[model samples]
Target: MRPRGIFWPGVAGIASGALMLVALVVTYGNSPDYEGRNGLRETVEFYRDAGNRDLTEAMALVMLAAGLLFLFFLAALARVTASRSSLVLVGGILFVALTMIATIAGAIYAITASHTEAFVVTPGTGTVALLLLDVSYAGTVAAMVGAAVLLFAVWRASRTTGAVPQWLAWFGFVIAVLCLAGPFSAWLTVLLMALWTVLAGVVLVLRPPTEA
Candidate 1:
């Protein structure tokens, strides 16, 4: 497999990941801190305010876009690893499903955030929104786990088939270990995975195809 056809998918993956990271930072950085149990009201206010609505929308849209692009990246990865190991293929597919779930959850939260006025007006709506946010975060955690599994499988495949360098395999193992640390480390795991994805894409583009 030449990987020539999949090159654009790699590029799209990197671009989307970059955009998602930037949009996420911009969305959260400018917003007020909404941590702790007492922070729900503040979160409601932040979303309700007209000035912050645009950032909320951007975050939502970018997440959705990133999710779509991530699918492309996963497909390319699965194709690359298919000949190397069945475990890698399965892990890639699982990761794709979990990531899609996370993306949908994120989109739902965005929709909820966009309609803060309605949530505020209707009793219990805010609670529901918060619950949705929790679910979205949970989905993110699960997706990260799926990514960890994929990376681990990739590492195993690399060891057997030499599809990727040993150092890269070790790097994947380290990231996978971090990802398995659960929700508290999710953000850091995500950032690391995003960087890894970009680097992997670049490496795929540059490396010559191996003979089957």
Candidate 2:
């Protein structure tokens, strides 16, 4: 937790991004019916049946790595010569907690994928419909909530002009807002989320602490 150097967080962020990119490639062009769409059933099956579930699960696990890296980064940040009770601490806690929650959701999604595999074999249209609908509801709620909490943490950090940049926090806050509207626009929300992640990671990696 002792502050090693500002570059350490950058290293961790890059490492996390590497792991995530791998997961993304593995799951590229693949996703499960864990979320239901009126017409996305066939599309979902194509991904799962193409032996892409592992890829999806791998992506899910990357979140665990991302969470750990951030944990270390935050720990180091917490050791800075400032108020330990500063917004940085709150932001750190939120990131850690929400990342863990997201990790859990990923685990659940992997388990559910197995069930979908079997359902694929039997071709149970009615059952598949129900499962997809259920996933849509549960997954959206989990993702939205976790993302919101993480973004809020960034917003919390934003208050500490020394520890975290205001722009990064606002970006995160906007992404969180987008995520809140997932029922109406999940794709847009995800796009914004991805953008926020990249921007924040970069900022955290490069920003130096301000003079108190």
Candidate 3:
């Protein structure tokens, strides 16, 4: 396909990353610290506020959109890299799937905390919320692992055959390494991925891979 053919996908990829950043800002900008010693309590308290619950729901929707847009970018990547390997596609699919699951878990947490009065009145309900939060965190870890694999695949393909630039591949490789740390380094991964996705999008728009 011509560069023109990939242009829209590239733009969509840019949107995907931008949406992720937007969602992060919306959810975390004024949110309470849920990573503190009393993390569960903090989360429960935050969601107790109606505004916080609304914001969580909105961000969850945004995240879902971002994940969908990312699939377009992933398909483009597979084409440009000429990667027949199922792992490349699988990795991308895994990231989206796990991320969707994580987002749903978060949304459920918000609902549980806000709508279910018993969540605060009863210990059992609170425990259920806590378990949901754990599921969200685990999903994030698995998603990042999948993202790391996808990035590694890109780096490997770009080493010689893929149309992507070597520098981008190297950057992806580094990000993939960081991604291995999963939730521990997720913040850094988000920042790096935003940059990488934008750069990759630009490349695809400007210079699509051609058959040799």
lDDT of each: 0.67, 0.54, 0.77
After superposition, candidate 1 runs with Cα above 4 Å error = 1-4, 27-32, 83-85, 107-124, 209-212
TM per candidate = 0.82, 0.59, 0.85
Q: How well does model 3 score by local distance difference test?
A: 0.77
Clashes of 1: 0
Tens digits of per-residue lDDT, candidate 3, 1-212, equal 43336788898888888888788667657555655788667665766678877888888999999999989988887777775346668888998899899889867867666677766623445456667767877887788888888888889988867557899999989999999787798766866776787788888778744454
lDDT of 1 at 75: 74
Best by TM-score: 3
Ranked candidates, highest TM-score first: 3, 1, 2
Worst 10 residues of 1 by lDDT: 117-126
Give candidate 2's TM-score. 0.59
For candidate 1, give the lDDT.
0.67
Tens digit per residue, CA lDDT, model 2, 1-212: 22346567656755655564554445434554444464355544543453554554566677667667766555555544244334555645564465455445444544465656554433354345445445544554455555566566557644653445667667767777776665675435544554555555576567665454
lDDT of 1 by residue, 1-212 (tens): 45545677778668766866775567547653446766577666665665675666666677667767777777777666666445655665565566556556544544555565454422245455566556766876887887788889888877777766688788888989998788988767767776777777776666665555
